[model samples]
Target: MGTGVVVRALSGRYELLDPLGQGGMGVVYRAHDRELERTVAVKVLPAQMLRDADFLARFRRKARAAAGLSHPNIATVFDIGEDAQDGEPIPYLVMELVEGETLGDLLRRTPLTPAQAGQIATAVLEALEHSHGRGIVHRDIKPADIMVRFADFADFADSQARVKVMDFGIAKLMSETATRLTSTGMRIGTPAYMSPEQADGRPADARTDLYSTGCVPYEMLTGRPPFTADSPAAMRFQHIYSRPPG
Candidate 1:
């Protein structure tokens, strides 16, 4: 498709509109699906990324991993397809359009109270519990990867919000390519929140996500990640050796 041109996908069923954001791997666009008659989010890898056979394979793997999951706290994957516009293959993923700010974005404005942060962490743990039960480890669970939607919670001591986890990794997809696409020496998962095993480049399991999960609430309540470093390598070293502040 041409720049600034509105194009249809899946044989003119979905209409693409202005982009929502661009990340290292894909650009997300707000779109309309005539068949469903509702707004949705579409994430697409640039046409150039498609040329790499390995990347394409990993892309499909990530899509499948997210697609297999079904939970309210997890973003819903609606469809996966390649653009048929003029033979340029741009792979795209259709997802539920969430209306809220990321936990990271909210924290930047002001830190949350302990009670509020605890509530958010509880919701995230609920989501993680489900994924873990199915043998899926999120691998990346920082504040930026968590979404908070407005809701009522008067009965509970926790904050009134619904949490949604974003960007659950599909094994090798993140381990191999995320940093490569960004031209950064750092690994895919943010350094501060990375579990020791992940930071050390050891194979990760469900416990890896649990380690990152512990880091989220620390930042939420304290306004900083448990560890800090000037560089990715330094951060990895801290994760492997330093103890978090009490």
Candidate 2:
């Protein structure tokens, strides 16, 4: 492994070209997979977060579980490996390279029409149905986590597009860590769209994702989430107490 803002991993099998995005979980990069001869998305977790032995085992187990999922609307997880930089094992997951802006970015430009919104909702529900049937719950489902796959990257505001759900088991992985969440500096779930049970630190099941499934389409149709707040804690509170706007 190399060092600095851009680096290669797994003995140069994947070359980090540029960063796609960063969040509470990790930084995702647009990368070149030399072995496969195709572009891919690589999520490199913050090195220190997965350093512990027990947590590292859990991370691999969960990643392997997510890899079993296969669906057209679910971003495919291709492989997982560690990039040991200076003996610090930084783990990464290779995913299908989806070329499109996030639904969050698309909505920032304009809200979707009912027709388009319906399409996205249908796809998301189908994706959830498939995952739920397999007993996997996507604890965090929001616009940012949904990729609106482009027929063409140039058409940022396409009226119709397919959606691919990303980060399938990430929230579950965060919660399963042997260490406290404070140690990893990662939020367990996104607040505004989280189910009331999830927001309150209660056990979440398939219904939790269905709750967010409804929330995302509402935001797509209305240009705003069902609830909003000045802080993460406040947003979670609203999900627990305040009724959703009608």
lDDT top scorer: 2
TM-score for each model:
0.86, 0.89
Off by over 4 Å in 2: 1-5, 150-159, 175-189
Give the per-residue lDDT of model 1 (tens digit) for 1-246.
Answer: 323536655547768888766645556778898898999988776555555668766777778777888888887778877765577667778888887878988899766767788888998888888888877788878887788865643444544777888766543464456655555433355678899998888998989888999999999888899988788899889999999898
Q: Rate the local accuracy (lDDT) of all candidates.
A: 0.76, 0.80
What is the overall TM-score of model 2 with all chains considered together? Answer: 0.89
> Candidate 2 lDDT, tens digit per residue, 1-246?
223358545557988988888766677888899987899998887655765567677777777878889999999999888777777777888999887889999999766667778888899899988888888898888899899854744554664577899888766776455236565465544577989998888999999999988898889887889999898889999989998788
Q: What is the lDDT of candidate 1?
A: 0.76
As for candidate 1, its clashing pairs are none
Residue 133 alpha-carbon offset, candidate 2, angstroms: 1.1
Candidate 1, residue 133: Cα displacement in angstroms equals 1.1
